[model samples]
Target: MRIEISVESPQGVRAAAAAGTARVELCAGLSDGGLTPSVGLIEAAAELIEVHVLVRPRPGDFAYARDELDVIVRDIETARKHGATGVVVGALTTEGEVHDACAAFVEAAGDLATTFHRAIDVSADSRRALDRLAELGFTRVLTSGRRRSALAGAPLIRELAGRTAVDVMACGGVRAANAAEVAEVTGVRDLHAAPRRPVGSALTGDVSYAGVGVPAGSDHFETDPVEVEALCGIFRH
Candidate 1:
């Protein structure tokens, strides 16, 4: 019955804090699937609220180049300094294995809890990825059940939870209408959502948002309050 919302803007975080949510995933450039937020915003959000903040490194794809990896590592350090409670990250090997020490990433995460992000989804094999993450000591794994949306992938997600020691968190296309069903189908207690008002993308960054894929028409990529409230209603049901 826990709720988590991803917020890219300070305004969104304030709204999420006002909504009385348990945790908030803080980042920026959500128009591109969540780029690293400024240190100021991170610190400011941390100071004003009690919600746990999970920071994302880049807004790009799950496959990170060496430089991007460095950026991710540096971003994590900044996020931690600014009071992030945890972090979300994922890196895939060519064969789709989790890059090196799943434990090392966990360790790199320091005291904050770590949740390997959707990079696990693009892997060649989900089960092997699950085992590696579990072995590496990740607190949770965010997945869409290996399908585009969580609902479609629920079965695989559920199987994953059953097969691995790591916690499985259902994500993608999670909304009020089917949040509970996805949870039920996936047997996943944790969930992640990026619900934003149907606003148009700003496109100010002049960077490519192609890989992130904005759903139809939406301005922001962070979780939307309207959606969260509705989903909460169902989850409570």
Candidate 2:
């Protein structure tokens, strides 16, 4: 089994490396479900660990316009240029099918490994979408079996794991507490998560830069290395 951690900052990347994760899914704005990280961040992360850059231009739905697709392609190129080992991406059609524009992303990625992001969860049919993504030559697909968390979707995840030629990386709300059960039930070897804890800022005041859902005084979140090690320990036995 391999553990993959989602990380937004250099410290998070270092924590993943220190904990010996298989790779780190490098991104920015993880609170918004992860947008593309800066080129500098990508470069810095690549130096410490195997970095798989998430090529999302913005948050929200996976359906993208031509210009947005173009930007995503460029971002893939940027990830490769900066020493990324892989790229995580996905695009869906307005009709809730896999978008044809995804081919451009793979082409731009060149020799890098590719993972279809959780966009498959919102597709018209998760099984059909996985098949199409496999045909498109996606190396893997990150999914929670169309559910909010992998544990909640174990049955569908197990079914999808059996049905696909492409690797099924179980993600979404995965944690040390449920990691072993998720792996056992879903029969998946790869688990992905951003194990984070809030760290208060030194600049304390009534003022706030926190977004919605974030508490007024919270500074930011940091990936917990202890949590990463605990999750990794589950598979060691």
Candidate 3:
């Protein structure tokens, strides 16, 4: 089984490489699900390991405006220029179907591998959407079976793995504890994990980055190397 780890920082990418992950989904703001990482981050990550840059322009719904899509395309090109092995992207229509504009997204990828992100989970019909992605020439689709976690959605994930020609990469809420069950139940060839370890913020005084009445804290999460190593052990054994 191929183990892909999502890393938001260059440090995370290095940890994934040391842990022997098959690939890294390079992005920023894991708190926002994921957004396109900077070109420098992509370049640095690609040097450490095979990197698949996320091309999301924003955090909200996947239904993108023309300007937002233009940004996504530009980010895709940037990722390619940085030697990304693949690009992760998705678009949806207002009615929650796969967007027709995905053609441009795929084209922007040129010869690089393209993996449709979990925007399919919010689609009207995930099975039908998977078929649509396959027709669009997607090399893979990352989904958690339209559920909160892969273990909870294993049945549907398994079905999609059997039904789709595109690779079904099980993702979302995957951790070391449930990795084996998810792999066995879904029969997937790839698994994606982003296990985090919370670290304290060094800012001590009245410094607050959170504006607009939001509570202020510098505490943040980063990929945990121990978690990555433990998860990788499942495939090794």
Candidate 4:
């Protein structure tokens, strides 16, 4: 029932730690679903927080090309070098199965704790993917329980947790009101939640979507300490 918070930037990491969050998944540009953080962010967060830092690589999509996977591989190496305690990544094949390429990364990470990211939902078979991750020695997999939202996904999350040795980390749509139910059903020790809204892209691409902002009613992903406290408060009892 420990609360793990994801920080999309260096400031988010500092704020999460100050709020007493248990861990920070250090990444960037979460509006596009997170990317590898800069070395400065990782190092600065490590210095400030007692909580573990889980680094993620890549900006979009789990199914990556060779060059992109190389970026991820290199990021893992760099993250470890700069004090990240763990790394998070996952990949799916063209057929929607766990990509075998990830197995090499499971080896390359070399003892920095690793979790297969939410690509679990994209896999055609969650059962097979979880089993493969355990075999590959991934410490965990972030999932929304194979449903659109964690609330609806709780059943499958619990099922997966009961069936596997690999840690099942529930995320997406997990909020203060729902943490206990998720933990109670899934029997998971770790939880990942981002109680913040998006800011802006550190950099932009040619791709454009009109009327698309941070997806927050507000303008930015400032840390919401109250949200963090409320979710942690739910598990306090």
Candidate 5:
């Protein structure tokens, strides 16, 4: 099985590479479920490991406006220019179906590999969305089978994996503890995870740079190389 880690920074990419991960989905604001990474981050990550830039413009739903689609297309182009190995993207219509505009994203990517992101999980019908993605030239897709976690969505994931031409990558709340079980139950060869741990900030003060409801001196999260190694060990064994 090939393991793909969701990484937000150069350190995360280095950690994943050190642990022998196959690839990384490079992004910013991973706490917001990932957004497009900066050009520098993409270039830096590409040097460390195979990097697939996530082309999300913002947080919230995948249903995007025309401007957002344009931005996504532009981001895809930027990722390519900055040395990204591939891109992860998706879009939905108001009716929760694959948006026709996603074609522009693929067109912008040119020869780069494309992965339809977790937006498929929120589609009205994931199976139909999978078919549409395949038609749109997406070689892979990341999904939790429309459930909160891949383990809970194994039945649907297995069903999708059995018939879909596109590669099904089981994601959402994947960890070393359940990675093997998820793969076994879903019959998927690709798995996406973020083995992150909080590192306490050394700067301690009453002033805080975090968003609302976040505590002062909040710790930042980073992908732990040891955790990545543990997850990789499961597939290796």
Candidate 6:
């Protein structure tokens, strides 16, 4: 089993490598489900662990405008220049089908391994979408089987795993508590997890950003090395 740790900070990158993770999906702003990480973050993480930079331009839907598509492509190029070994990217049509824009993103990635991101979860039909992604030359697809969690979507993951088109990575809501069982049921060798915990931030005093309240001393999400180690231990067993 190969453990892929989802990391958003420099600390997480070091911890993931130290904890025996095989790779790290480098991203930023996990609260918004993840956006593209900075070139600096990609370069730093790439040096410590195999980095697969997330190519998402923003939060919300996967259907992107032409300008947004351009940004994603540029980010892919920046990641490559910074020493990233692969990239995680995807796009969906307004009709919820895998978009042709994905092909452009993959091409921009050049020889880097490209894995279709979780946008597959929102596709009109996952099976058909998976087929389309395979046709696009993606080596892997990260999905939660159209559900909020991989454990909840294991049946479809198992079915997709049976197909030879591409490798299915079980993602979303994965943790030490159920990582082993999820792998057992889905028959997936690749597992993606964030393994994070809330920690107090330096910000003080009541602050609200666009009506959302931030407490005097806010809290931020940070990856827990112990959690990563625990999850990796399950796969090793």
TM-score top scorer: 2
Clashing pairs in model 3, backbone N/Cα/C closer than 3 A: none
Misplaced by over 4 Å in model 6 are 202-218
Please give, for residues 1-237, the per-residue lDDT of candidate 3 as tens digits: 999999999779988998889999998988888888888898889888999999998889999999998888888888888899899999999999999888887898999999999999999999999999988989999999999999988999999998868999999788888888889999999999898776655777765464222234536777899999989887786
Ranking by TM-score: 2, 5, 3, 6, 4, 1
lDDT of model 2, residue 237 = 67
Error of 2 at 130 (Å): 0.7
RMSD of each: 4.5, 1.5, 2.4, 4.5, 1.7, 2.4
Candidate models: Cα lDDT each: 0.73, 0.91, 0.89, 0.76, 0.89, 0.89
Clash number for each model: 4, 0, 0, 2, 0, 0
TM-score of every candidate relative to the true structure? 0.83, 0.95, 0.93, 0.87, 0.94, 0.93
lDDT of 1 by residue, 10-127 (tens): 7777777776666777767766666667888888888756434444555555666777677667777767777888887778876778887445456667988788877888888999
Q: Write the per-residue lDDT of candidate 5 for residues 150-173, one digit (tens) a residue.
A: 999999999999776899999978
Q: Local error of candidate 2 at 220, Å?
A: 1.5
Candidate 3 Cα deviation (angstroms), residue 77: 1.1
lDDT: which candidate is best? 2
* Model 1, TM vs. native: 0.83
Off by over 4 Å in 1: 48-59, 101-103, 200-223
Enumerate residue pairs that collide in model 1. Answer: 103-136, 195-223, 195-224, 199-219
* Two-way TM-score contest, 1 vs 2, winner: 2
> Residue 182 CA error for candidate 5 (Å)?
0.8
